[model samples]
Target: MRPLKSLVAASVLLSGCNGMPVAFTQDPVYDQAFVVHSGGPLPYMLMGTAVQWNEEYAVTVKHIPYVPGSVYQGQGDIQFFRHKANGVPLWRGYTPGEAVTAVGYNSLYMSVKGSGHALPAMVRLDAKEGNVLYGTHDGPVAKGMSGGPVFAADGKVVGITVAFLSSSELAALKRPDLASQSRVSIFLPYAEINREWGRYLAQAQPVTAAPTHLASR
Candidate 1:
């Protein structure tokens, strides 16, 4: 683990200000995933990534920071700039220190440059009972990474980015120096996500095309 940096970069949050994620691969899934937009204005700016769960709804973290009463908040919209995701639910299973990929808006307004890119990250599992399925690691998980999908070694969704360890939490673990290394943290392993969100998948309907006009015969 790396030494602690300033806490400004500490604590992973739910994801961002909003913009589309650039293409990570030619793979249809990666191509389809992009930042999703909602809400409005400076203070209300909000963004996150979502996968095409099925026809009706995409899977994303439930807690969005910019939404009112949320832990994180901001304002803007950018999903329109890129292709809306058509990704299927991710395949799951992971190990500590495993290589994983994270795709989301890293910047609040996409002003920070590299923030909107779909990048690779690693998994750092903490040895705690409650966090058994969940884990902590060097995210790179910035404000916009929430709701972004965490892909496994096989390149499938294993987790949805959720919360990260805070400076205080690190101190409690007696690893105060690791704050920097732990900065941009991640939680919400896919196993847990599937258990919770899986039920709805079956209940969902398939995406279908609109009926054609066929006006004159």
Candidate 2:
């Protein structure tokens, strides 16, 4: 195993939000997220959630199998376009430390993983249900959720799911024992993720109708 990389590692603890941790799913933050499929034999095998950033490209963890890279190295051999969008993207922003919701797309990868930690395939965040932001939560983020998005208090975008924290990584942080804290999903801050892809979003344009030309026959 290459080891998880986003769970409970390097986070910014926020305040004011409850910290009791809710169930696997009940919130609608997953509404803002869509299932992304990788073009492969098992289209659903390499699936995760993609968050809509604007009008052009949706965002997800680049490490997800949907992201183009070497699978042997855990870089996700497939891409994020095999599946189609199911709904509209989010249209709001998020605040730090506010209890939000999350949902994971049910994928074959999860089935193969033996339901690691007994967590559901979906994600959810709530204000009074231990849905803290900036760092910390007590839910459940399974293996296939690598590219999912973390929601804010009002169903807005906050962070993009990264990966689970490995034992060595947890030990380095001196926070060994990630038993009940399996839902402490780690995500890349929205601003940083934006900065990395803002230019692409700004420049990406949709195809429009072509204009007629006098020389055309």
Q: Best-fitting candidate, measured by TM-score?
A: 1
Candidate 2: what lDDT?
A: 0.42
Global fold similarity of model 2 (TM-score): 0.51
The estimated TM-scores of all candidates read: 0.53, 0.51
Candidate 1 C-alpha error for residue 96, in Å:
2.3
Where does candidate 1 have its weakest 10-residue lDDT segment? 72-81
Error of 2 at 35 (Å): 1.6
Candidate 1, residues 1-217, lDDT tens digits: the string is: 5432222123433333223334333454444345654544434365666555444445555444333222211111101112233445656666766666665556543411112112234333333223334454454445766666666556676666654555564565564345445354555565565554443333345456566775333
Per-residue C-alpha lDDT of model 2 across residues 13-52, encoded as one tens digit per residue: 1111112222243344455555665545445445566666
Indicate the residue-level lDDT of 9 in model 2. Answer: 21
Best by lDDT: 1
**lDDT of model 1 at residue 175?**
49
Q: How close to the true structure is residue 150 of candidate 1, measured as C-alpha lDDT?
A: 67
